[model samples]
Target: MPKARAITIHRHFIEPGTDWNTEDFNFSDVLSAQGSSGDALSITPNFRAGAAPENAVGGGNLVDIFNAAAEWWERAILDDFDLTLNFGWAPLGGGTLAVHSLVAQEGTPNRETEGTIRFDNDGSSLWFLDPTPDQNEEYQTFTETTTTQLGGGDINIGRVYTDPVGDAIGRFDLLSLAKHEIGHALGLSRANRSFRAENMDFDIDVQAPRPFPGTEIPTRNGAHLTLNTSLMFPFFVTGERKLQSGIDILANAEISEFNNINLNPVHVPEPTSTPLILSLAMGVGTFVKRKSLKRQSGL
Candidate 1:
């Protein structure tokens, strides 16, 4: 087993007053290959039946949704690396929809090699797995009365949609959640050194007399992006399905560049072109262990 530094927990939350819009955004259209000859990125998912069943929700395949999420990144990042992600279900406290724990490299606190993702199975909120896209746009808006570690509040998880333009009001989209978690695994987080360095550069480039328009201020304890539509945003709305915006791809590209890996940049948008979307309501937090731990087998 490989020794790893302390686990860094990235939690996802459900916020109120956020609703899905009627925009048809395909990740493939925005993240198409830029003719890079680098090898494709490979992600191996290990579904574990620990604490709770891996696919507790009925009527949909959790593994399939996870793979779909992985594919989204694979298309954008062409680096040649094999990453293993352990998936499981557990009671991740309240207000949290899911969590991503990165296994840092031994003796190197800033470098991450693998990760684990656990979904909320504590019966706090209803879960739906919409395997296909639904065009009906009859969804309700919600509000958060109280906030918890994960994002505790009132929500209506009635339906699920694979894409962002469907009608899945009151329901959390599993596909979208998976994509957000995987972004953390791929180094789109401020917890990683590369991400932090890139963010600092972004700020400097836009400050004072610079020509850049905005700054890269991280929210949620420096773990998530603030005031942006990046998939790595901490707050998740009930029915909204967000794809990887240009900021997300650029963030990951910085990580790849740090690792000396080349990525396809054909469709990656300029950082200035990144749009600012509605800011959702929720409390964002990250749990960082001060001590190191032995890496688990097969993780």
Candidate 2:
């Protein structure tokens, strides 16, 4: 997870015009891997700014933004656990459907193989569909597969990580987007319309969807605005980085299982040059019970 013994970044899936082949680029440079001072979730984006968007505000250095996003997650949730993320890079050629496309492969004890695991495919690969007002890019759907035991928890076989946020038009925060996707890869899914039950988003099993308690957050201009606290919320505004309590509870429970894993993960080099390999062991990623998506009332 920390180091990609061997990694590469291929072209992304495209529509209408030209789709980048999945074997276009290979990344050896580790842009940022800071779970907390040591080896944590990483971003290997050393390639030129070609992958970055034109309207990019950070001097077009997507690498910095991406790392910060990863770092935020590290601090917010998975920081305690010595986790390593071998990121697969796909420098933005143009505006794409999704910014990040990940495949979370879960493997349990008896059935360590990914295919063997039961997937609650809602028929759609989108874990979290955003409020992308622009409506242009078409990364469309995302899926998951394969499995090999990684320590204790499931290794998120992040097939391909892309960015949905456009450089200039995208007011989305880097950490916000990364955290949202990472949530799914780490067993979190879009809290359906029926997310909140008894004021609990997951309630051990995902329930009806309910907008998390909105906090009065201040804008840069000193104006205050209310933003939903649920990180798993479906609709995405420009800058939303609130970590809900329930998600924390779930992720914490998941992390406890990893306590059995060695502080440092053993790097298993892959045959393919470009691929993020993550496998969840039995107690965790198995028996994925998709919470019924019964619409509830909320914003």
The candidate that wins on TM-score is: 1
Give me the candidate number with maximum lDDT.
Answer: 1
Predictions in order: lDDT: 0.45, 0.27
Q: In order, how many clashes per candidate?
A: 8, 36
Q: Per-residue lDDT for 1-299 in model 2, tens only?
A: 45422111111112222333433322111111111044333323222212333333424233343454444444333322322232322433222212322222323311000000011112221122233311212221122321222222332222211233333233443434444444433333222111111124223221112111221111110111111233444444442223232333233223222222111121222322333434443344422211111222221
The count of residue-pair clashes in candidate 1 stands at 8
Q: What is candidate 2's local distance difference test score?
A: 0.27
Model 1: per-residue Cα lDDT over 58-153, one tens digit each: 245566677666666665665445566766565655567777665542223244466666666676634556554221122222111211221222
Per-prediction TM-score to the true structure, in the order listed: 0.55, 0.35
